[model samples]
Target chain A: MTDKPRFKSARESGYLLCIDCEKLHPLSLEGELCDRCGARLHSRVPNSMNLSWASLIAAVILFLPANMLPIMTFKSFGQGEPSTILGGILHLLDQDMLLIGLVVLFASIVVPVLKIIAMTILLCTVQFRLQTNLRQKTLMFRIIEWIGRWSMLDIFVIGILVALVQLGNIAHIEGNDGATAFAVVVLLTMFSAIIFDTRLIWDNGVTDLPSDNSDEKDTP
Target chain B: MHGTPEQLIACHECDLLMTRVANKPNEDVICPRCHARIFYTSINSIERLLALSVAGLILFIPANIFPILSLQVFGQSQSEIILQSALSLFDGGLVLVALLILLFAIVVPLFQQVILFYISFTLHYRREGRLLRQAMHAYQHLRGWGMLEIFMLGVLISIIKLKDIADLHIGLGLYSLAALIVVTTLSSVFFNPHQIWHQIDLRRQKRATDDR
Candidate 1:
């Protein structure tokens, strides 16, 4: 295989590429709209870190009610019981549906917590301008982004159940407030990941920004 | 067409900018800094994309038409189709949630597949039209909203959740939905955005030269 050629960042090369039109423009036109596609041009997404942090914080706050409160209430013959997320998983386990239980546990509980934690570490490392594990961090961000949508699995399940099991008070299912909270948590985290610019993680690694060097040292 | 000051491209992952170079078919131009794939020249990409999308469209019919799951409790069995789940939710007064499921699970995915088929078919036959740009824009915007795979997983979880309460049977619609998910994902994997954009650019350039 032939060795790939080395590259400089658009920031370093004094140019910005329009993501929509793929047209190249000089960095001097950063604040101006793209001449070809009418997209606003920026060498990097402005305020990416701040937006990610805000959404991430909102997701973390909502994560509690998503797990603690009852996601749905099961009513059978005038008797009702509310089931939290963990309760539902354990109930499935109690009935010996191990595979489904494990799948729900992973998708609903494990994945969201892990995503939030992983994103936190990623955001912190990038915000602090740590130079270690740049490659691994980038890969982690990609995986997090790819798997983020699967967290919606629980919401879909609840939605399907609430619709399917209604038998007019014999065995009806009603969605509780927790379902809304859980959906919001999923959405906020997705927004957080979307707003995060993965390119910033590598910016401090290879490129030398003479102005930002002092700010980098200030944190460390 | 050989060497016109190779236009520069930026790496979406690591922000590395490099001059674009022509690649032989089946060659990938990977970013040097972060090892991310920048672009590639694939052989017969349009043909592969068209085939996969058409297959997905066929499967989508069975996915929505038949009952996804049936529940039997106390000698009364009721089967629920994909749309029924959303309609039932609406009856239960969860209007917004019902719309969300319908949009993500059914409408958006169908729209995405149709758009893919349209773009690939048009490009393969070299049809010139103004709708190509709008189609490409819609594809990019709606790509993230297609959640068939997530919905399928939800179906599985629901089956298991209802197992003890009622006798649950997976219907033909479930299998078709699964197949549709696989076909749509394969189509996306084969459909490279940069390559399609390059084709669009080439067509525009040809038209400009012809006009001149």
Candidate 2:
């Protein structure tokens, strides 16, 4: 005696809703503009996977240089040293600025890695149509989207440092290639997450009309 | 909850035909099929959003114009305001980084707050739905690009990193920058565009029924 309807989705009932305006139109009106808001109504975003894969692969490729090349160059008294992301963190740790060092470590290093890995897992789940953990996958996407932007912190810090630390023969900080690569990496990951429609993950599993949403089979 | 077919809302995350349900204040209505948060029923969404965005717009001015920090290196001292700090990168031959700073830290933040203020204010006074819709779209698209909070963290990290290299003094701009970051973040969390869209839906439906 469940109250839920047989049609699991508006798509199943041959309807597509405007995401912005929340107005439902028949699926046949796919290419037509939503009269209320003018957003082109589609049952689903076309080619969401292909674009997500492209952005993700590019981010993975750029992640190498983002970590390997020097992120910033600090020069003092005619001596210059270029430091990578990890090198900078080590330098801070060497100075016994443990708290700030950990902060940088989390934002610069951990967050990107976490975002890339999480995005990959999400893509695979949808790509293979893995029916399990559909809800968990959506939650993961939200977490990554919210935290993904914070990875820009390191580059902003470097920008300010490069701006403020110029002194002839005393101290100077220079911007480097790694900063650009890192910024690109962050941007690409953000693009990938945005392009991915989390709805696709449920298309494989949500067909069952009476499925309990809280399928805590994998909960700890 | 409205039972009209026009009231049917689809889940963007799962494509479920979610029934229209009354939203209790300070609660969330999530899609059952995918657990995507379909509605964040923030009470007084427009009023709260207006207050927060107004505070952010005010703070944005001083946060950009006032000197943020002054650094003493050997016998030389250089002071920087937020806007000039980003612009000065052009002189150092870091045009790309400079542009990034100007964009993510400067242009986007101002535009976002202004757009939010406009949308909330206009919607508050029952302005044209078409204009409010356009502003709403821009606000949504601009959400991901603004980085004032990240910029604040950068300011803190840069201050610490410079301690071993130079003497530093925090300025009014830094404090304003901190305050601006907080207000904008609160603006983002508390402002929900869904409420505006729902209001638009109500008007459209009422118009349809009245024409009958």
Candidate 3:
């Protein structure tokens, strides 16, 4: 954990590390191939911004229907009750299961929203080339990648309940449109995170500038 | 490492180029600019990874087959297995959601355990038959899709959600699934993907020299 000044980027030094295999290839080489693993090499992930932005935009559109529409319908004695994402959380809290309630609220609601917002901010930072708070933004991106999968919690819950709660007519659970939408939302966001190139954050509008950081001599 | 030229490593997060340092066991090299991990080391990596994957595979069947919980409602008790989670959803006509659940909760995790075991076993013995690179490549791709731990949490939350409505009893599958989650997470925490790549490269090098 030593903090030091930035140095020459591999992009500027004219080499690329294979994102798949970590094999380094000089950028000037024609037909760049990862000599170690043979994955086609790219200096930066090609079309990273476009791919991530496309995925993120789709996720943003899906997020609404995912939350608003009923995910599951619980029926007891022919009486049907449908619950949205927020509705389910409120139901859990109303049952006085404080810890479980908060966990659901966090997983089902908070995490997805946070992930969406964090990804947007990171994308904007890259698009606008905002160098301030780059480290924190990168850290946030890491956390986003790790936590993105957990947003599937709600879908899994619906799956389990839909499977388990079928007791003929007395009580049963049925999956709905929201579950599908939510599942797609989770997948899209995860893809956006995966498609995003973290290195793009550090380019910091300096891809064209020939001045590499000169503080390498004195800095630790 | 002995006869190779000095390697230059680039930070994946920030793209800063730095000369690679051979890491001691369990050492992690942190990127100076963005504090991302540049190097991750693991001791007995292949053996430990294989052990965990084998353990996960052993638990996989029972974890999916046995009832996660049995519910008692109006004196009629019924139990639900983990696979039913996906099967039931598909029956309900939420085909995509069902398939996603099937993929994330059951299929992908099982595939991961098998692929991991295959990759590690092949890498450990330096066995030749399968394409090691493609196998390792698939293993890396599978890592993102498997959500075993998240599924475990969903199990717990579902249990709590249904607790008030019915008398629910926890079952063998839940216990096994919990163990599976612990084993997989532990293996992931201290893994060295590069070590696997390096070993495969060594094997290639050895074969090349033998040809000469």
User: What are the per-residue Cα lDDT tens digits for candidate 2 across A24-81?
Assistant: 7888888889876778877887888999999999999999999999988888898988
Chain A TM-score by candidate, in order: 0.88, 0.90, 0.89
The 10-residue segment of model 2 chain B with minimum total lDDT is B1-10
Worst 10 residues of 2 chain A by lDDT: A211-220
| lDDT tens readout by residue for model 2, B114-160 | 99899888778766556777787788878889998888888899888
Better of 2 and 3 by DockQ: 3
Residue B137 alpha-carbon offset, candidate 3, angstroms: 1.1
Model 1 misses residue B62 by how many Å?
Answer: 2.4
Task: List, for all models, the DockQ compared with the true complex.
Answer: 0.40, 0.49, 0.56
Error of 2 at B191 (Å): 1.5
The DockQ-derived docking category for candidate 2 is acceptable
- The segments of candidate 2 whose C-alpha lies over 4 angstroms from its true place after superposition are A1-7, A209-220, B1-4, B201-212
lDDT for each residue of candidate 3 in B87-164, tens digit (9 for 90 to 100): 999999999998998888888888878878888888877788357788777777777788888988898888888888
* Top-lDDT candidate index: 3
- Candidate 3: chain B TM-score equals 0.93
B-chain TM-score, candidate 1: 0.91
- The residue-by-residue lDDT of candidate 1 on A114-210, one tens digit each, is 8999899889988888888777888888888888888888878888887678776678888777877888898899889888988888777744333
Which candidate number would show the highest DockQ if scored against the true structure? 3
